[model samples]
Target: MIREPDGSIKIYVRDNRHPQVIERQLRNLDVRADVTFLPPGKDCREPRGTYLPDNPALLTSEPPAEGKDDYWRLHPEQIKPGQTFVYTMWYEEHGDNRMFTARYRVATGPVAPCEVVPGGPVMKEGPEGGIGD
Candidate 1:
């Protein structure tokens, strides 16, 4: 986790383990986030909370090119009161390769616990390497 001079927060999750610790860290940063790491074939049900319209300016995957850290840059100020960020991550292994996947969601008001269920088929093409890829 890195806090920028402009008040934006950048997070890079190199290890998906210990999600509860991650949630606690984000909370300490004054960011309301619910982090969940699903098992190999599991996923969270949709509509876990009130959905917020997609806004790249508020939360984006693209990182600044010059930085060595490829973090998810977030403008927390853009997140209104009563809003919480939800992150779900999981990975699949094929032969010697592991494919990591992450999904981000925003919820307003009360956010419900993630309802575990079997996830859909893996994408034909996922990020080839780590997040920096």
Candidate 2:
């Protein structure tokens, strides 16, 4: 239940308190799914990743699961040096959960980030240098 790219991670369980449950499930069941966006109605504006929709006073309304539209768009110019991403998720009994934040990595590539440039080929890691000479 950890998502990469733009969307957040989602964790659903019958009953589990500790956040480690996710790790256990992933390891035990071999749950392999690359997260790319907040699974509708799971994303929130809270500091930590968790959901308690029943208590309005406790939390705010979250958007429902969505597709790529929920993705956080990034452009080449927006990327900078020294950027390390760390996202955390928590799950409680009888409740839905989501990732605290989307993790991102500053991979060494063509020296330009082009997540929102629409068209145009961007640099990428190849077997040896770039394609051809």
Candidate 3:
């Protein structure tokens, strides 16, 4: 996730394997968003829900939405390995006090339906209670 100067959030999820579908589950206020699928062999640094460095991900010229909305659903048929999916939306931060969190599950294989990967440990809070690795 990349936090903007105006306090918005952009999320990037890369596909290291095959094509897949995803649902953006967000709460609070509605948001405007753009979704994209990057080709394979491309390089994108995961934001880890924080800052945006000098080198951001290479995306298509036209992002899906230039306005705000509540959510977006993506289903890419051929996200080929190494490709990436991106979502840029509002973060809706409260007055100096907001808690942000994230959890993801992935499944991919040659079967008719993908299997769910077991859940892992929850993220531990940082010393300062800020989002960090």
Candidate 4:
């Protein structure tokens, strides 16, 4: 997690391998979160719009019935290989509050590295709190 100078935090997941899919389980994340996506080998990061059709079906606290585990499902809508998935979170406390943390583990699909950077805010479209964020 990257602590910003303005007291915000930036969490990112980077895919550096062949084309693959990534899923993140959000057990906490009680505060406001802005999810952004960055293209492969590019610095431009844009907000990933809502995952419709499956938006309501996706679980943010518990896994799906067919899910192997019980955790919220968060993934990039169109993240290809070498792309970066970033989720920036902001809290009212503005300090070291560990309550808004998300955990990442090895799944059966692919393996990617996570990084933290300086960022803030995000754009939104469609419904509110899309993807259960």
Candidate 5:
């Protein structure tokens, strides 16, 4: 974790394991976070808690550059009290390629445990599809 001059925190996560440890570390930094690392092809049910609306200004990410690591920039000053940040990550494999996915959510109340379930299917629309179809 790197503290920026703008008072924001940048966190680079290279591993999806040990979510509990990550949560503890964030708590030590006065950042309430609930972290969960799901298994491949599994996901948590929606409405895990009373989530806040999406705020890109408060939280944003940048892909890795030539010599930099991928990181999420979090402006804690924008976060209100009693709010908890939720982070979920997983990995997907397609043939010989592997992809990492992560999601961020802010909740005002207690967060629910990650009840693992199968992920939904990926939908693809073609040019033949109609607006009412």
Candidate 6:
């Protein structure tokens, strides 16, 4: 999650991957969000926390809002569109267990443009410096 100058958060993906089950679970848990952003490659990052202030994570860091913090939700204004953010893969698998889950940590940075692969339709390409095809 990249923090904007205004303190709003912007998650980036060339395009959106909507209607995923994770999103459904978030809704069930009362998390209000629009879409999921993906980096060019499957690997990407997740923000561990934000820096609004010494305690930007808590709304109370600024002003008192009863017992709850206004920033407690960590929801920022609008995520600047077209920015590309990604994840870093952390795989865990026991010697005997072939199954494993991959975790990611968000890295703050910018993603240059990219091009589509040749095997896919439209016969497109990505920016020379962009990650993944």
Candidate 1 per-residue lDDT over residues 16-97, each given as its tens digit: 5678887887788888988888866677887788878876687777654684644677688877778898888775555555
lDDT on C-alpha atoms for all candidate structures? 0.74, 0.29, 0.29, 0.29, 0.73, 0.29
- The full ranking of all candidates by TM-score, starting with the best, is 5, 1, 6, 4, 3, 2
How does candidate 4 fare on TM-score? Answer: 0.20
lDDT of 2 at 92: 20
- lDDT agreement of model 4 with the native: 0.29
lDDT by residue (6-107, candidate 4, tens digit) is 433333222211112222222132221224233222222222332223233222344335733223344332333333334422322123221223322212
Instruction: Give residue 55's error in model 6 in angstroms.
Output: 6.1
Cα distance off (Å), candidate 5, residue 25: 1.8
Provide TM-scores for the models: 0.75, 0.20, 0.20, 0.20, 0.76, 0.21
Q: What are the per-residue Cα lDDT tens digits for candidate 6 across 15-98?
A: 123425434533444433333333323332223333112322322123435773222123332222332122221222234222
Predicted structure with the largest TM-score when compared to the true one: 5
For candidate 4, give the lDDT of residue 115.
46
* Model 5 alpha-carbon drift over 4 Å, by segment: 63-65, 92-98, 120-133
Off by over 4 Å in 4: 1-71, 76-78, 93-133
- In model 5, residue pairs whose N, Cα or C atoms come closer than 3 Å (at least 3 residues apart or on different chains), thus clashing, are none
lDDT of 2 by residue, 24-121 (tens): 54334333211223321243232222221322221122443554222232222222333212122232212222222333333222223112222222
Backbone clashes for every candidate come to 0, 12, 6, 0, 0, 12
| lDDT of model 5, residue 51 | 92
* RMSD, one per candidate, in order: 4.2, 20.6, 14.1, 15.5, 6.1, 15.5
Residue 98 of model 1, lDDT score = 56
